[model samples]
Each structure stands twice: as structure tokens, then as C-alpha cells.
Target: MFSYLVETGHTVEGAVKSLERKLADMKLQLLWKYDVTTKLFEQGIRLDQDYWILEVSHPDLTKKMLVQNQWSGFFLPCKMVVFSDRETGKTQVGILRPTSAFSHLEDPVLRDLASRLEEQLISVLNEIEQQQVV
Candidate 1:
């Protein structure tokens, strides 16, 4: 599936924080936070870059999906990523859209859920600005 990437003016850290704040306002619980390069740096592995992943889950939706298809677990808890372009101090935000996960699921209900998530994700992304770096 093609990525839903957005150019953001905020620094990588700022972008993630903004997204988290918006998600909280929407009542979405953040499930996990992964700092890719940071982890590697801790392990003495140099990445020479910055990357982060955030996962959010809605309890009710997750349970309903489990009852319908266990496979849906793979897509449960929406995820978004933030990565930096060191040279420009700009950040890029993206997600693997939930609607794309419905490709072979064959369930209208799930499709509806994904559609709603797609909207919410877009909504979240819309709240952040891609600032012009001078």
C-alpha cells in the first residue's frame, strides 16, 4: 500500500508531540512509543538518523475486531511514524492507513471502522503544521 506521508514544518520531536496531544484530545490511548534510532544508539549501533513510532488503541474497537477476526489483531491500535531530515530540520509524518488493511478482510463493518479511523488519522495530521524552515 502506498504510504500516507505528509511534510511537516515542525522538528521531528515537535511533530510527534503534537500528534500525541491531538490523539489525547480525541480520547485515544497511546499504546506504545518506539524510538528507533535512539534504541539502536543505546545498543551501540549507530543509525545516524532519528525515527519514532507511536501506536494507539481503542479498547472497544479492539475487542469487536477480535470477535470478528483474529487476524485483525495485526492492524489493531492505529500507528503513525515520525522521522527527521537532519539536513533540513524538517519532519515527515505517515501511517499505514487502516482502510488499506481492509483489502482482503471482506467485512463491511470492519471497512466502516477503517474508514472512520482513516478520517480520524487525517484529522490528527491536519492539526499539525509543516512549518517553513529558514
Candidate 2:
């Protein structure tokens, strides 16, 4: 799949907190967070489900990527999302697979880097999935 998604046994808020902790453990920084639900509400569009987009990055990795191919900057500061699954009424966490996202670039080095990054991120998601709501 182009993305990696996993269901978590926590509410959206709980899941986000867990995610932040996991990102920290992996040495990734949470640079920004966008509350999609609140943004829509402010614009008078009701999005009943809670949804948040987190922008995360590893400074060293990002620098390396950009140095290898400036075009890779477009994919820097990768994104992960936490949201209420509409049908299941459960929380879900996911990330766009970096390897897939950079597949078109044809650079083997970048591809290897993305694969390693993707593995780290998937580990975070899996850890979150195994945690209980606290």
C-alpha cells in the first residue's frame, strides 16, 4: 500500500499523545500539528470527526535528503495523521509510505533512506497500536 495505517485502542486525543511520545523516542520532532476538525469548524464547515495532521522530521535525516536531491525537500518533514475512523468510531494513525512517495525519483540512495525512515515510522505506529488508552 502507499500508506501504513493501524487502529489504536485509544481515543483521538490519547492516540495523539501516544504518538508524540513515540516520535520523541524515535528521535523525530513534531514540528507542527494541524487540527483539521477545528479548522473546518472555524470556516463554518462541520467535520464531526476529530482529525489531526502531524508534521514530523529528523533534522539530520532531512538535511541529508535535501543534500542528496534538492527536489526531495518537497517531501521533507513527513506527515502522519490521527483521526476518528468514521465507520468504526475508533482512532487510527497512519503515514504515507516514504518509499512509495519517493518512488518516482529513481535515486537508489534516496530510496534506501526512505525505506529506513519508513521502518522507523512503522515501528512508532505499531507501538501506538499496542498501547492501551490511559
Candidate 3:
């Protein structure tokens, strides 16, 4: 399984709420774990036997936009986590799949994941490019 951590200063709860139905539609399951004492929220989205973890604080509109954009760059090859700063309106998404996380994902699985991600990203970029042209 591959996994990543995406962080947003926005409400983690709100982000999870926004993603719940989409994940379900994609046949993914979302599990939320919050430690009030530590004021930490970690929500995991499981899709096709892989985990994509999003860590965020209140709902950041920018982060939401990225998710809505469905950027394939955010989901290719391996798992990743991003700590997004909505204030700066800049995003830094990264791969964070530990070696142990790959135990269940074979080469073919990796290729399939990367291919799907690439296709999705291409679509997103195309849309963005078109918007810019408009």
C-alpha cells in the first residue's frame, strides 16, 4: 500500500467532510483519527488497497481547490503527503510511502497506480491550461 501525508491549516474535519463522498464514490474508505489532547487530526483515505493520508488544520480554500482540481501529480507512482499553506497559496506535496507500506503493492500495482494518476493529472492540467487560455 502506498501513502502520503497532506497538511492543511484548515479544519481537518471540514476537509474530511468534503472528501467523504468523493472517496466513497471512488470506492475508497476514509478513516479519521483525531487526538484532541494533542490537537492533531489525521484522516486516511483508502483506495484500491492503498492509503492516502491527509493531515490538515481548519478548511483551507486553496487546498480544497487543489483537491477539486484533481491533480494527478498529487497521486502518481507512490504515496505522498503535502503540507499546504493556504495563506501563501502555495502547495508542497511529496511522496512519503515507507518501505513497509509497499509490502502489499507489487510492480504491476505500482504501474497501474502511476498510470491512472498520470491520466488524471493530464486532464487537470489540460483544464487549467484551457482556463488560462480563456
Candidate 4:
């Protein structure tokens, strides 16, 4: 399982809908979507394959954390690892796969495929900007 934190580019309602369509097109099942503003987490219609969580959050909030501090994608909690900073003052997040499995996947094909799919999805969202009614 490869964990990726994709920047949705925009955090508006329209962006969320666009992302939903893009994910469907990519064949990645929409597991759930969390709305930070409303504190609501809705379960999406199940698809046939792998599950994905799409979260819509303000880029500005992340930007502030990144620019003001020396943080990268480490702050967010990933599906593979549950991390809490306050209690231990240490990061618990680690690679999604076991060390051996992760190390074994050294081929460029997987990377190329992911890049192509991401670019295609972003392009689709850039063209349509409206509230998604799923």
C-alpha cells in the first residue's frame, strides 16, 4: 500500500466534486470524505477496488504550517500509521509497507504510472469548477 498525500489544489466544494470524479475515473474507490468545516465525515458509494480517503482542507492552513515552520507532509496522519505528537513528542509515522516490501519496489514503472494518472486527474478538475452533486 503506497500512501500519498495529494494536494487537491483547491479546497472549495467544486474542487471536492471534481476530485470525486477524478478518483472514480482513476479507478480508486472513494472510501470517505471529511469536511473539516462541518466536522462531518461522509461515506462515499463503494466501488469495486481499492479504497481512498479524500479530505478537503484549506491550503492556506497547511501553507502557514509549512512556511512558518519546517514541516513537510509529516503533520498529517496517514492510514498506515497513527501518530500523536503531544503525548510522546516524537513522530510515529513510518513507511506504509514493511521495510523489505518497500525496498523491493524499486522499479520506475510504478512511479511513471502514478505521475501520469495524477496529471490526468488534475487536468480534468482544472476544466470543471462547480459543486459536485454525488
Question: Which candidate wins on lDDT?
Answer: 2
Q: Give lDDT for model 3.
A: 0.35
Scored against the true structure, residue 13 in model 1 reaches a CA lDDT of 80
Which TM-score value belongs to model 4? 0.33
- Quote model 3's TM-score: 0.32
Instruction: Give the 10-residue window scoring lowest on summed lDDT in candidate 1.
Output: 125-134
lDDT of each: 0.78, 0.91, 0.35, 0.36
TM-scores of the candidates are 0.86, 0.97, 0.32, 0.33
Clashing pairs in 4: none
RMSD for all candidates, in order, please. 2.5, 0.8, 13.7, 15.9
Q: Return the TM-score for candidate 2, rounded to 2 decimals.
A: 0.97
lDDT of 4 at 50: 23
Query: Model 2, 38-102: lDDT tens per residue?
Result: 99999999998999999988888788888989999878788899999999999999998899988
If ranked by TM-score, best first, what sequence of candidates would result?
A: 2, 1, 4, 3
Worst 10 residues of 2 by lDDT: 57-66
Q: Point to the candidate with the largest TM-score.
A: 2
**Which digits, one per residue and each the tens of the lDDT, describe model 4 over residues 83-111?**
22334333222223222222244434433
lDDT of 3 by residue, 18-64 (tens): 44443344433334433332333323532221122443211232233
Clashing residue pairs, backbone N/CA/C < 3 A, model 1? 9-130, 9-131
